[model samples]
Target: MFSTSIRFSADCVDDHVWLGDLEAAENTFMLDKLNITHILTILDYKPVYNKDDKRIRLYIEAEDIGSYDLLSSFETCYHFIENAVQNNHNILIHCQAGISRSATIVAMYFMKKYTLTHEEAIEKLSNKRCYHMVCPNNGFQSQLQLYHQMNYAVDKTHELYKDFQSERLRTNYGLEKSDKITKTEKEIIDDTDRFPIKSEEKTLETEEVEYQCKTCQHKLFTRNDLFYHQQGRGKSDWSTKPLELDETICDKQVFTYYTDWMIDVFDSNVGDIHCISCQTKLGEYSLDGKKCECGHWVMPAFHFDQNQIERHNEMNHNHVEKS
Candidate 1:
């Protein structure tokens, strides 16, 4: 078991990068003590920090789950770390805990950038940090393997393409008419001619039917939340379907729900919302309504974290899938 008391700060992976937990990321004192110049937070919620001219922060909206399609963010995160290192800044990569999501990303970075095999990259990370804690979950491991294999295939194809071009040039110039193409080269050329290599794009399909608590297997929201905005006028009144909450079912244990008047005066909600049955954190309740990035005003009743909740498909009600 991982103990927060044992280690809650950053672990240096190299001169440029460090892996840490939420506590270290949130605490300015810790960040300053470590001389961390840049921070990369991969979490569901936005990080709250004081603006400082000396420090830079990057937030990637991510969930700390095995099946959260973290690979989709891999390229973006890798480039960010690369830029930070090139600029001679020490960067801290963190999630809620530094055990899984963040660790997986660091390992993938090494694998992709350094051309290290998955095992080699993971071993290097473990040697630098806590070996016991630097473990990616099974789903993350599988995805990492897939990423490695895909890259390997692309690299090999490029190499073969180069060889094929050289052989064709030699034959065309009559330098070696008797020279024959190797079986592998012939196959590669044929395949390349038939189907060109394209970049892989990851797509996230939203599960709009039902959202359930990860801990208790309790249904939190149904299709009722999916609706068009009644007041908006821009393109469409279709508000982003946030998990609509009934005051009776969800308990305001994490954050208390304030009335409309109180929210306007305070400029923020008082507390987070939680599941009444298990007291699991569901989300926050914004009484005055929060503006989304897509230019729509949504009443933040319960913003469910895709990592913390399991989504149930509308077509298959019995099967539960991870978001």
Candidate 2:
């Protein structure tokens, strides 16, 4: 006997209702095998809601549901799935063989769940579900694309602020300024400068170094000043390699070494951070130290194993040549 909550009455409309059948039994068995705890059926199409425990709830259509009609309010539907995932509910959403209506809901749900672009979520869902069905003239995909674009814009702005702060700190510490340091100071800061410093009476040269503008050849007072001149706020898209974290290090030092924003961009590759602009080599000086030659700021070059670094260099070299 089918419960009213999980059965359909044929006397009403087109006699579309479920009876004890092999296909229904097979579908139930498939759900069981997958360990699906619940199923929600929409439209007046009634199927047995045979589910494990009380975790599953089914809602039959109270009225005619159309492809163009919103299942729930657009905002409510988006938030409902988002909150369900946040609360750790493993929901397997379906509707009528997992195509059309169900696909629409699930497609939107995936976008909200994983914070993925509409195209990305749709592609993934299509791959997972052979149904791969999408409703034509659906605005959900376009709306989700707008969301992704907005997030990308915000991230870029935040990165710009962080880069500005790093430059300020470098300037304050005289790293980008004050080239009048003694030979001893020079040795302390950078040990690899091949040119020998000539100074009389142990006094460093107080004269400022002149830097010509790359674009206009305009004489600038300092290399640091020319840094501002060389800058025109162009975007730098560089490839990154991930590195292992030294968990033994103090948390404060680790935090200081890495920025909160960079941690996300750094994936599992090997430690190699190249300048997105000029492809010049980069290293971590301070939290504020990793500025590139193209005047774009970047995170420190994470040192991975030698083999890993070599692989990354090879990959980067290929990428640069391709571009």
Instruction: Give each model a TM-score.
Output: 0.46, 0.30
Prediction 2 global C-alpha lDDT = 0.36
**Cα-based lDDT at residue 264, candidate 2:** 28
Residue 16 in model 1: lDDT? 84
> Residue 184 CA error for candidate 1 (Å)?
52
List model 1 lDDT by residue over 1-323, tens digit each.
22224344778897689998887776666666667888888888886665553678788876666545565567778888989988988899998888888888898889977898878888889999864478888767766776686683323234343343333333332222213435653454344321111213211234334556778977765433322232223443345454332212111111112221111122123356566568777655554455433334554333444445654555554432323
Best by lDDT: 1
All candidates' lDDT scores? 0.58, 0.36
* Tens digit of per-residue lDDT, candidate 2, span 218-294: 32223121111112133443334232223121111111123233332332223333333343333223332343434
Q: What 10-residue stretch in candidate 2 is worst by lDDT?
A: 10-19
User: Residue 203 of candidate 2: its Cα lDDT?
Assistant: 16
